[model samples]
Target: MIKGIKGVKDILPEETPRWRLIEETARRWAVLYGFHEIRVPIFEVTALFARSIGASTDIVEKEMYTFQDRDGTSITLRPEGTAGTVRAYIEHNRAADPLPQKYFYTGPMFRHERPQAGRLRQFHQFGVESFGVADPRADVEVIALLWRMLSDLKLPSMTLEINNLGYAADREAYRPQLVAFLKQREETLCGNCRRRIDANPLRVLDCKVPQCRAATEAAPRLADCLSEQARAHFGSVLGELEAIGIPYSLNHRLVRGLDYYCLTTFEVTSTSLGAQNAVGAGGRYDALVETLGGPVTPAVGFAVGVERMAMMLPLAASSSESASVYVAGFGDRGSAAGFSALEELRLAGIRAVTDFRSGSLKSHLRQADRLRSQFALIIGDDEVVKGSAILRDMETKVQQEVFLTSLSSQVSSLLRIS
Candidate 1:
């Protein structure tokens, strides 16, 4: 039997409501922040990610699903959303319109990695990008947006960790000092950290290997290397966050694994999700637009893992409940009446359904009970002749006759109760 490929799982019907809630909440809050929606293709030319996400980054080096098309052109399913979004911003001449372009996107992203509890080969993300805003307040606002969305989701026990990576020149000065420090402990570091010391020393700080983590623990901090300008920028970002009462902690070792990010970086972690604890993260990438062949643009954005967020959502609110009504009919005349009444309830915007089989009233009532319907509208030859039908309350099992024309109003009254 054919099976779904490993690392991919179906989002069945029962689970979609929570997914919808997350997506809708993101869209709602995104609009409230004046961010317009932007849709990018699921796949793009391979070079887009390689250049924008950094050639040596794990996303590019190890995780991207890259392949060659029949035309022999390299292509890749997007591992993240920002690169494609920035590409679209450039391709469409969006920079010409305004100083700041705010866009949000929600969609599937692909990465080839060992799937864990909340992480998947095919995962969905809700991301937002703000371009052309270089002010430190832009950083704070992006962080605020993320905080607000997560807060609105009612997640429990979350912590926001932020750090300063400084500017390119600042990093250049610090890079040598960090390398020299790591070189002394190279024998104790993991193989990956040993290789990264020369290629991208900052990545070594992000390594999870126990020995490498210990080796880099006492190493030079990025904050120590921040240029005056970078320090002021980061300070101003913090000042804004403080003024607004958004609590955050500084973690000097929290360098994000992206080459493009600079100045300020952040991640929101929840205690509920073990191991893969980071629910969302992003940073300022002031040079990425120019790196991707567009005019220099300053941007800050963050993406939340939808699956992880879904996992933490409260189950009580998401569980299915009894629908408003089930329209059940007994015979030919009764079924016709029930169908007409069903349409009336529907056109009135009541949640209504019917068993079209025109089965016996007892069987139809049982079907309605099975469906968890709040009310069952039973129609038979006698009630059809009288221009009315019996409305049976499924829970109370109380029966009442109602005129066909007034069924909607009657049900509306019943549904309004606490």
Candidate 2:
């Protein structure tokens, strides 16, 4: 037998309700925040991510799933949602609109990584992005929407970790100071951190290595180097969050691993998943669109993992209350009529089912009992000749005969729809 590729997952039937609940909640909240749904393809030209996500970052260097097509063009399954959303906005010339465009998406995202806890090679993300909005208020609004989404899911005690990565000029000013600090601790930093020190020093702060953490503790902070204007923007974002009663905490080392993040980076974490505790995170990418050959556009967004949300919810018991009527037949002729009766029940808005092949009456009845059907209809030649049918309550074991003409309405009333 063939097996699914490692690191990917199949969402089984038993866990569907929780998935549906999260999707529904996100949709309702997105619409509430004036965002429309945008659907994009699973694959795109490989340059889209390499340019937008930054070639130096891990997502571009090691995590992307890139393949060369027959046309000799490279394509990659999207590892994140923001780049595609921005690409759609630019390709369609959405900037022509008078106001900012808000788009939300929920779909599978691919990444090449070890599968552990809520992390998967082909996991799903529900994200919302706002393009053309440069106001600090927009950043806070996006964070508030994410907070509301987690609360709606009843996720327990989520903590919001916020940081400011500083703007381009601010980074240019502080890069040397940060580099000097990392160089002094070169002997103690992790191998990855040591390599990234020259290319992207900001990522060194995000390292999870114990030795690197202790060594980089005294490294320069982005907040300390924030330009006067950048400082005002960060302050305004926090002020708006406080004005709207959203709670958050300052994490000086909260630099996200991605390269595009610049200012207002934040993450919502849960304690349920242990080491893989971060459920969602995002921040401002003001220069990403311009970097991808479009006019400069400021954007902010976040994505929540569906699998992690499912893990945090309570386990549900399997309930068999859905079946209200079951039709059973003893012969081929009766089987055809039984199916017709089943359709009639369904058209009348009743929960109904029937066996396609004829079987013994006792065996069919047992099947109905197993389904917990409230009502069972036994169809045979005798009932057809009498122009009537027997309706038995599987629970009470009571039997009654009624004219076929009135059966549809009777079932509707019994199910309380009428």
Candidate 3:
């Protein structure tokens, strides 16, 4: 037998309801916020991520799956949703519209990584991206939409960690100071930080190495580097969040791991999960559109891992109860009657199943018991001659003979009582 690939999972039938609930909740909440759904291709030109997500970032460097197609064009499976969404927005000239555009998408994202709890090589993300709006109110609106989405799922113990990375001018002014501080302790820092100092120095603050963490405790905060204009904008964003009663915390060291992010960066974390427990994160990317060779447009968005979301949502409340009706037949003639009755039950809006293979009544009931069927419709050669079925209630072990024409009404009434 052929084995499945490592670092990927098959979502079994039993786990589908949880996935369904998550998707349903996201669709409903997204619609509530006036965000329509847009889907981009799973694979796109390799240059898209390099220019938009940052070539030096881990997502583009070590994690992405890139390959050449038969036509010799380089194609890559998207590791994140925002960059592609932005690409579509620019390519289609969505800015031509007078109003800001909001879109939400749910799909699988690919990354080549070592598998761990709640992380997979091929995983799913539900994301929202808003374009053409630079107002601070837009920031609060997006964040509030995400918070309400989590609440709708009945997730537990989540906190919003909010921060402003400031604009390009603020970040540029602070880089020298941040670099000088790191340079003083270069020998004590890890090799990654050593290279990061020259490449993407802001990332030095986000390093997870214990030694690097010890070495960079005194690093200058981004808040102090904010330009006067950037500071005012950040203040306005906070005021809006406060006025709307959205809870948030100021994390000085929460420099988002992406270079494109600017002005605002935030994460929603859950306490139930440990260190890598962030369930959702996003920030503004004002320069990303211009950087991608499109007319400058401001955008902000967030992506939530479906796996992590599933871990937080309570399991289905009624999963333990039997909800289906099973139809069984004891002989070939009885089988014909059973199938016809199965259709009748289905037309009457009953969750009904039937045994195609002729079997003993006892064996069929055993199968129904295993399936946890709410009721079992038993048809035998004698019953077919009489044009009636014996309906057995699995829970109460009560049996009653009902005419063929009356079975649909009886089952419908029983299900309604349920």
Candidate 4:
């Protein structure tokens, strides 16, 4: 039999409550922050990512799932959300609507990478983007939104790390200094870091290799080279974060992997998730809108890996209260009556279920108990004949006889008390 591909796992029914909780909580907090929901396609032209995410980045060079369509046009399954969101922002002429357009999106993102505990070939992300907001307040507001959402989820041991990548001009001036430094340690640096020395030198600071990390320890710092405007923007963001009581640590080497990001890059890491600790991250991308052929627009946004966040979520509390009633029928007449009652209870906003197979009263009760059903409604031939049924409170082992006319209301009242 054919099976699901490696690295992509199914979200079984048993595990969906936690996913629902995360999505609901994210939507709730996003709305509170004035972010409206936006849905973008899962795939886009390959150039969108290569141009926006940067050609030298690992996402475009190694991780992207790129394929040639029937027309020989290069298409790719999106590995991230920002590029698609900005594309939609420009395509739909959203820039004309208002000064800043806020959008939040949640969906599966595809990448061809080795699967790890929290990382997957097909994963999900919750992202928010705001366009045309050039002020540092936009940066602070977006980070605050992420922090608030995580707090709402009750995640523990989270750390927010912030850094300034400086503007393009600052980076341009610092590039030669950084490259010259890395070149001196050419043999000591990792192969990836060596390649990036000339192509994208700043990414060397983000390298994970032990030797590279050690070699770059004394490398030039981007923060030291930040232009006055970049420094003021970052300083203002930190000031606002302090004003709002959101504590953050300054990480001098926190340049994000993407090339579009510039100034005020930040990441939230969770100690609970080992190795792949970054739960969410984003920064200012003031040049991306123009890069995508739209008018120059400044935007700030962040994305949290749903898989990673789900890992850190506490095991959901298990309560039998959700499934309120189980309908148990003994015989043909009893089955019909139980089925009808199930429908009636559901129509009245009661959570109800039934066993399709005819079984003994004892067997039905056992099934109800196994399902953790709050109450079991037993319908037998006698009950059908009498136009009433037995309601058994599973927790108390107490039974009551109720007429069919009052069954829905009685169940509702009983549930409220329980």
Candidate 5:
């Protein structure tokens, strides 16, 4: 038998409730925070990522899934969400329309990486981006949205770590000192770290390799190189987070993988996720808009790994079947009437399911039990002849006969769908 690809997962029927729960939670909070939904193409010109994510980063250099098209154009499946959102913001001339536009998107992202728990070649992310906002308050707002999604999900042992990557100029000043430190310990660093030292020195500090991490432990902190303005911006973000009572700690080592990020950066890590503890992360990027050929627009955003979040979900969230009703239609005329009732219930805003193929009332009830339906709308010949259907509480096995015409309204009332 043929099997699924490595590092790629199929979210099966049994597993979708958890995903819906996570996605729905994100959508509800995004709406509460004034973030509109935006959908972008899954793939874009490969240069878009390389230029925005940085050529030196692992995502651009080693992990991107780039393929040549028929016309020989290099296209890549998006490895992250922010770049595409910014591309749309510029290409659609949104810069001229408004200031501080916010958007949220949930979908798949591709990267070439080894398959492992909480990591995948084709994983999903629920991300939000806020554009054209330079205020530190915008940073705080985006961080609040991020915290809301994870906090409401009730994941345990989650910690919010914030940092100041400072501005690019600040990093430039800190670079020589950081590069000097890494160079002194060059022998202990990984190959990736050595290459990153010259190209993106800050990344060497961000490296997860044991040797690279230990080697840079005593390196000069970027916080020291932060400009006065950068310091104020980060200070405001921290003070506001405190004002809002969102728990957080300062972690100078919390650098994002992308190169566009600057100033305030943050991550939410859960002990439940093991070594790959980061469930979501993002930061402010003040220079990316101009870098991508648009007017300089400062933005802040975050991306949550949907798979990792799903893994952290409690078992109670695994099933979403309770809110629906099953229509068990047996026999010819009863089945026909049942089909009509199914549509009526659905049109009235009820979630209804059916198995007309069930040959007997016993079989139909069996199927409804298997579905874990809260209520079963049973229509057999006798009930059809009476112009009524049986509403059986699958859990209680208590049955009631209601006229077919009132089935939708009755079910709607019973399910409290109004």
Candidate 6:
């Protein structure tokens, strides 16, 4: 037998309801915020990611699955949504249509990496992006939408960690200072952090490796480097979040894992997710549209891992019990009567099923028990002759006879199903 690929998972029938609930909840919350849905291709020219996500970020350097297409153009399975969404925004000239166009998308994202509890090689995300909005209110809008989404899921022990990355020039001035500090413990830092110093020095603060984290504990905080305008922009975001009663914590080191993010960056983390606790994260990207070869546009967005959201939501509450009816038909004439009743029950707004097995009454009842149906419409040779069928409540083991002529209405009233 052929085996499925490693690091990817099949969302089997028993698991779909949990996924559907997460997806529907995200969609409902996004729509409430006036965000429409936009979908981009699964693959795009590799340079789009390289330019937008950052050449030094892990997603671009190691995670992305890139290959040469038949025409020799480099292509990659998108590792994140914002870059692709921005590409579409610029390609379609959405800037010409509206001031701040809001869109939300839910789909799979591919990254070749080690698979763990909630992390997968091919994982899914629900993302929201707001374009052409440079105000601090725009920052609060996306952040509030993210907080409301996870809160709506009833997830446990989640905290909102917010950080200010300031503007590009703020980083440009602070790089030498940060690099000088990093080089002091050069040998003690992780290989990735050491390499990032010359390329993307800010990433050293976000490193999760124990030694890298330790070496950078006393490193300069980016918040101090924030420009006067950037500081006020971040302050307004906090004031709004507080006014709305959404509590948040200020984290000085939470430089998100992307190149385009600037100004406000925040993440919602749940302790229940163990060491890798981020449920979702995003920030303002004011320069991305211009970077991707389009008119300058300001944008902010967030992406939530569907798998982690599933892990936080209780599986039992994710799915509701099915109210089903089984048609247990015995004998040739009984089978014919049962077939008719099956269709009638469904048309009457009942969940119905059949095994198409013909046998004694006892065997048919066993089938009904296996299916765990709420009601079983049993038809035997005698019931068929009488133009009636027995409605057995699988739970109470109670049976009643109803006419086949008005089977649907009679069952509808008898079971109170309709």
Local lDDT at 121 for model 5: 98
List of clashing residue pairs for candidate 1: none
CA deviation > 4 Å runs, candidate 5: 209-211, 322-354, 374-418
Where model 1 places Cα greater than 4 Å from the true spot, the runs are: 319-322, 405-418
Q: Write the per-residue lDDT of candidate 3 for residues 304-377, one digit (tens) a residue.
A: 88989887766663255344799987787788888888999989888898666638888898889888898899
Worst 10-residue lDDT window for candidate 1 reads 314-323
Clashes of each: 0, 0, 0, 0, 0, 0
What are the runs in model 3 whose C-alpha is more than 4 Å off?
314-323, 405-410
Per-residue accuracy of model 4 over 299-392 as CA lDDT, tens digit each: 9999999988888876553222457899998887998888899999999999998778647888888888888898999999999999999999
lDDT of 1 by residue, 218-246 (tens): 99887888889999999999999999999
Residue 280: error of model 3 in Å? 0.7
Model 2 per-residue lDDT tens digits across residues 285-394 = 99998888788888899998888887898657223345788888656666667778888888987889866543878888988887778888987778877777788888
Model 6 C-alpha lDDT per residue in residues 372-403, reported as the tens digit of each score:
77888989889989999889898888889998
Candidate 5: Cα lDDT at 315? 56
Q: Give the top-scoring candidate (TM-score).
A: 4
- Tens digits of per-residue lDDT for model 5 on 48-123? 9999999878899899999999999999999999899999999999988864599999899999998888999999
TM-scores, all candidates, are 0.93, 0.94, 0.94, 0.96, 0.88, 0.95
Residue 390, model 4: Cα distance from true site in angstroms: 1.0
Q: For residue 314, what is the lDDT in candidate 1?
A: 67
Better structure of 5 and 6 per TM-score: 6
The superposed Cα distance between candidate 1 and the true structure at residue 148, in angstroms, equals 1.5
Question: After TM-score superposition, what is the CA distance of residue 374 in candidate 6 from its true location, in Å?
Answer: 1.6
Supply candidate 1's per-residue lDDT for 143: 93
Candidate 5 or 2, higher TM-score: 2
